[model samples]
Target: MPKEQLREAAEGLARQLERQHGVRSSWEGDCVRIKGAGVDGELSFAGGVVDVSVRLGLLASPFKGMLQAEVQRYLDEHVS
Candidate 1:
C-alpha cells in the first residue's frame, strides 16, 4: 500500500479500536499507548509503516503475544 493509504488504514484501525473495544490510545511519535487493555498493544504508524506490540504486564506474561492476534481477529470481524 502507498504511504498515505497505510496511514489512513492505520488511523481507521485506531478509531475502530476505540469505538469497538473501548480501548484508549495516546499517540507518541509513531507509536500509540493503548490503555485499560488486558494486553495493551502499541501500534506504530509512519510512512506506511505499521507495527504492533502487545504488552502484557509481568503478571500476565503468557498473554504478551496474544494481543496482536486478538486485535487482528477483532479487525477481521469488525466487531462493533
Candidate 2:
C-alpha cells in the first residue's frame, strides 16, 4: 500500500480499537509488503502458528513495535 494509505489503515485500526476503550494514543505506520509470500500465506492460520507477512519500508522496526505496544498498553490500561 502507499505510505498515506498505510498510515490511514494504521490510524483506522487504532480508532476502531479505541472506540471500545477510549484510548487516546496516536498511530503511525509505514508501507509494508511481503516478498515471496505465496497464496498459502494468505490462507488460514494453523494452531499455535503465527503468520507475519508485513515487510516494512523506510520506517524503523522499533517505531512500529512501539506504536503497537502503546496501543496494547492503552488497551490494557482501559480494558484489560
Candidate 3:
C-alpha cells in the first residue's frame, strides 16, 4: 500500500487497540510503539510491509499465537 494509506491504517489500528483493548501507542519515528497492561510491542510499516513485534506478560503469553493471528487478520482486512 502507499505510504499515506499505511499511515492511515496504522493510526486506525492504534485507535481500535486503545478503544477495544485499552492499549496505547505513540509514534517513534516510523514505528508505533504499543504498551498496555500485559503487552508491549512495536508496529512498523516500511517498504509495503508491516512488521509487528509483541512481548506479552506471563499471564498473557499463552494467547500469543491467537493475538498474532487476530492482528494479521485485521491487517489483511484493513490494510490491503
Candidate 4:
C-alpha cells in the first residue's frame, strides 16, 4: 500500500480503537500516537511500508495477541 492509503487505514483503526476501547490518538506528521488505559503505541507509515509499535501495560499484556490480530485484520481489510 502507498503511504497515503496506509495513513487512511491507520486513521480508521484509530477511530475504531477509540470507539471500542476508549483509546485516543493523534497524528504527528506520518505517525499516529495512540494511548488508552493500558495501551500506548505509535503507528507510522513511510515509503509504502507500515510499522506499528505497541506497549501494553501490565494489566493489558494478556490481550497482546488479540490486539495484534485486530491490527492485522484492519490492514488486511483496508490496505488491500
- The prediction achieving the highest TM-score against the true structure is 4
lDDT rank order: 4, 3, 1, 2
lDDT of 4 by residue, 1-80 (tens): 67777888999999998998889999999999999999999998877778899999999999999999998998888987
lDDT of candidate 2 at residue 12, scale 0 to 100: 51
Point out the higher-scoring one by lDDT: 3 or 4. 4
Candidate 3 achieves a global lDDT of 0.86
| Candidate 2 residue pairs in clash (backbone atoms < 3 Å) | none
lDDT of 1 by residue, 1-80 (tens): 56555545556777776886677877786676776556477777565555677666676677555556766774455322
C-alpha lDDT of residue 31 in model 3: 85
TM per candidate comes to: 0.57, 0.32, 0.88, 0.92
CA lDDT, candidate 2, residue 21: 31
Residue-level lDDT tens digits of model 2 in 31-65: 22222211111111233221233333453454557
lDDT of every predicted structure (CA atoms): 0.64, 0.37, 0.86, 0.91
**Ordered list by TM-score, greatest first:** 4, 3, 1, 2
State the lDDT at 53 in candidate 3.
Answer: 89
